[model samples]
Target: MTNAEPLFDPSLPGLADDPYPHYARLRRTDPVYEHPAGYWMVSRHDDATAVLRAPRMSVNEKNLAGAPADDSAPPPELPPAMVEATNVMNLSLLDVDPPDHTRLRSLVTKAFTPRAVAALEPVVTELVNEGLDRIADGGRVNLMDELAFPVPFAVISHMLGTPPADSDRIRELTGRIHRSPELLDEAELIEGMAAIEELVKISREMIDWKRANPADDLLTALIAAEHEGDKLTADELVAQVLLLYAAGHETTVSLIGGGVVALLQNPDQLDLLRRRPELAENAVEEFLRYDPPIQQTRRITTGPYPLRGKEIPGGSLVMVAIAAANRDEDHFGEDAGKLRIDRADARQHVSFGAGAHHCFGSALARMEARIAIGGLVDRFPSLELAGDVVWSDRVELRSAKVVPITV
Candidate 1:
């Protein structure tokens, strides 16, 4: 029904803010779409699930921009900064395949357990309440700035045993790497990589400290994690911790900001939530379904795979659109497009992805949103947008830079 040749272009102006409409059109017409550049996308719910869980699909692709390679193609001269950026990209558990991914993720899962996350609820509640106290004196405030950003940043920091004094600088450093490196200039890109290196150094020092004086924290637990005569190396520990730090802080920030805006836009659902505070659990799920934090994640195929009954070639980048799949009518029923806070199957959405690569911090994210979003509605029933909301203008991250609200 739509004539858009490339529906998945990232450079479009408003694509990041509202991609569901585009996703709907594509899902109806072409569920398995391939790009001229050999990049394919699987947008349907079942296809998304299959591709994510398929043995043929791989996450260990070298997606570095403007970097040297040992392949057949002639090498191009690249700046040292860009090469350093590529090196940092390689350090992530995101770019590794099994055995390595299995090892790192097993250690991470042990530390980021549901029990560990549940124990943090009291502290998370106190953090949200303190933020509320600051906003109470001021009738109007930017929730993204005053509340949403700080709460998760604090929680992840506390979990990692990162010093409280270094919170602001660490937060600033993490902010530098949230967006794509290609979007930045030479100077900005260098600064971002430097921030990453600095964080790695900080993590390495902490790992050493934890070894000496063990504590009851995620970092200490990661240090204590060991397999049958095998354990994480120094670099693996630092990299995994950095990955956790980035993923933990960044995604939760998007959830809180985008979830609050969703409530403001739907007054009836907002009122229902204010009336029944317990709906917070279900509300968090719907918010992720309605507008997921991460839009698409890229993976490559190792061999031929069938998608939507069509066999695509091997070794092509398949961008799985989580935002689109969550909105598919076939999977979520007739009212899939609507933001129903009480939707029963809301938890079935792939907002946190599926299978092995699924987000490790989903439990922590949902709990934070329920407590923060739910607690706010309970305290300030009069919460509504003060002015126009501004979204983060990027293709990958679906979030807001500002949400002006009056409580």
Candidate 2:
């Protein structure tokens, strides 16, 4: 590992607002810097990829040091109810280990297969057009609220057979739960948990309803999936559905939001994409590399592992800074900081992650982004930013709370 000093604290304020600079420092200085937040931060491309792919690293919370013996318990300041709901509903394919993760992911992967996502292209295109139609007559629109957020939300909602009318409510609940970990005190955590409980209730009811009368949706698929002659239990079904609903929409929302911001900031890149509409796909890849939705993912060391001459004990936390890895000079070249839409190595970035936990819905997310972005430029050639951008204070997911733009 390169000997470099860590520039910014991952836990500092406004860090999420712009972490690329900090990531750059970490990559150049301390590639595997240890953070006081109780984790080793891997900022370099190769190091981050190694941690992500290493079998010794696990997503299971059980590996978290000093964590409650009951995996269902919330962290120190979190409310009990919130902890329980988080433990129950958050146990999707992302939070488990090999056999469990593999089994759970396999059961849901069929629904997100390339063919399945491709089939939704027309539908996604139509949805994008509809959203654009709403804003076509507008003076200004918050792209996140009006376009970016709704596109993925609608797509995922339809995939799960959820009514379009319920999208806003679901979004509110999930957004709260996602941001709860960043809250200052136990009270806020309690409120966040309450919101999560409500989400759980809604998800559970939906699963029950789907079970009674199955539909051709992902929820129905998960409800029907069997492993070793046994089907997913009610709790397992609730957990998986909730996880899908949150993960399926939230990250994509950020990608579209961040992608729009990236393009607007780099007019040259934006102009190039507009000129070569075919480059929409490449642009999406660049968007992911330049400004990924999910910035960091946590892993627990399941066994003693030697990384960059440091021996980390089992149960130690490892925070992989994906946003940093994408911009690593070693991986993307000296001009990595420059936005090159035509960069041949752009798709090699780790925005959707790598290895066993690579995003299953990456293709779907890309399809939505391509059609939505390409269609926007086609319909509104004069599209431009209308006001200051306001980003979410979320650490894990980087997104704009509001991106005012004009058609």
Candidate 3:
């Protein structure tokens, strides 16, 4: 399990079912591990936090110093259709560094501010109640479809003022494109690339329509958002809107779905939450820490990064295991593995990440989860698992694909 023994492969079977045990072993034996996949996996909470918060850490994939100037033929050019898609990917908020990252973030940061997100509480509550009503007669209903997906999807769609008619297609495309970041073979990568191209096309059409018809929504705000006499270029607007529209709801879907699954599996905590509904906010934090929506995030080293006694070389890819860090025994003590709704320091989890690249939709996601999950708990006093849970294959955005439940 330690770095000295052999290179580790994080894509081992059954990891999605439970990664904490593997993460625990890595934290104990090789807190800072260099994986054979040309990346470093940092499992400890302290190391993960340091790497995430480090100013030198980068998110740009171009920072990876590829094999020294190979004399082989240059790589083939991307298809014309893919060029636009690739450009959109390059301009993504998750892939850019500062100045660009700062600019892009500042342009829309106000929309996600706590005050702005608070204004959506009534909207979120209404959506949550509506979802509950849909599942009121439920006996073995799929929470993922009934509550998790619809709530966030509706919320983000409303925020973006996107056409509700296209939601089904958008969800499918987003799911396919999101698989690009996970462990994939050649065929899967090609499929993901195609998905990205499709999403970009769809997004462009949406943006074009939004322009002709402006509304008091996030998409309109992004369309008009400017900073320092700078406005988003047409392509930049498409990129940001696509990012916001896609990423905005994906994580919240995980949060609500995963949060519900956690409670169903931990009866005591569920009972406690039922008894003390006031702990809803703290319960959301605990859910994030116990089983984060995002399991890992990555950064590239701009310079030698030291952790424990090892020094990761410059230009190396570093995968910060946020899920592992959240459960680090040294950080959370012996009960780190257990879920406690009232865990005082649960908010300290790096689930939303740290530093400049922290998730932009955090406040919105929190509000959605708090309301969606809390409302469900309140509505169903006798809720229980109807069958075994089935988790999504996605490695980063962890969530149960299906949580069969009875109310």
Candidate 4:
């Protein structure tokens, strides 16, 4: 279809630059495509939403047919240290099933609820203003480094009560770790695993420090969190902290980075947002709908799944294309491909996903984006794209590595 064999291939030319066209083609020709890679790709909005909403759809790889019962066990070829690092990740909310997901999610669920996130509004505003202040006197600066990454990164770090000095190292390691799902070669996979190992070490050290220096922060609360006298194990703590540290900012980075680029590209929308900063809230949802950070999320079907009239075999790895679904014409209307900050149904987009496994940090991410993006627009009326947008090589975690801008 569209002359792009195995449309899921990340190495395809210009894919990182613009994937929406291909996604549109897939949605048109094959809404429920079974990829040659032994995975299924659901492109239509309805199908994607249905797959994500299905309670039986499993997030854990071990649920797949013929998969190892103990999915944490590494093959003989992989290094033991690598396996150990991945095992820690295996305990995170992103890679678990119902009971464990329910338990782990419930533990910290209150921390990120809308009301709790609202309490952090003052802190988020301060962080956003500080980030904007840094870029105010700038001529040309990479927004990714200056505003986009730092604001969310600072927010997450502040919440976690992590040592500020260790952030650069954490950023580097997390960048590497986020590349794991990019269909890596053996060597690349090994490198990613190594990064995970180092990050796990850092997380453990941080957790221990938090134990000694307990404070009124999310990290301390996590350390103290207990459900029916059952606390998160040491490994689970490491996994969760790492997940929060990485995801807490990374997705929002994409939001701010990609959103700004979209606005700059569409001058009309930029003008509208600048004139009416109140649209910032709606703009955040539009940004997510237009160009979502996490493009696709996967679900391992525990039983035969019917999607768009086809029966996908049990244990199938089905990719729910969130980005594509966000732009589905049937769902969002004919101009779904276009960016409209005022779109009434913007929040209806499945960018944060749906059902049980919806993103826990959605409230926080939205708050940060609203403040940060709104602050940027309000402060810099003449903010212009000064140079090319350097897109990240990541397919799943879609974001620009650099977005040079001048205010």
- Rank by lDDT, highest first: 4, 3, 2, 1
Specify the highest-TM-score model's number: 4
Whole-model lDDT, candidate 2? Answer: 0.80
TM-score of each: 0.88, 0.93, 0.94, 0.96
lDDT of 4 at 402: 86
In angstroms, how far off is 245's CA in candidate 2? Answer: 1.6
Total backbone collisions, model 2: 2
TM-score of 4: 0.96
Looking at model 2, report the run of 10 residues with the lowest lDDT sum: 1-10
Q: Scored by Cα lDDT, where does model 4 land?
A: 0.85
Tell me the spans in candidate 4 whose CA falls farther than 4 Å from its real position.
1-4, 72-74, 180-182, 226-229
Question: What tens digits encode model 4's per-residue C-alpha lDDT throughout 134-191?
Answer: 8986767889888898888888888788765466777777787676265689788888
Rank the candidate models, highest TM-score first: 4, 3, 2, 1
TM-score of model 2 vs. true structure: 0.93
Q: Highest lDDT, which number? A: 4
State which candidate, 1 or 4, has the greater TM-score. 4
Q: Please report, in order, the local distance difference test score of every candidate based on alpha carbons.
A: 0.79, 0.80, 0.83, 0.85
Model 4 poorest 10 in a row by lDDT: 1-10
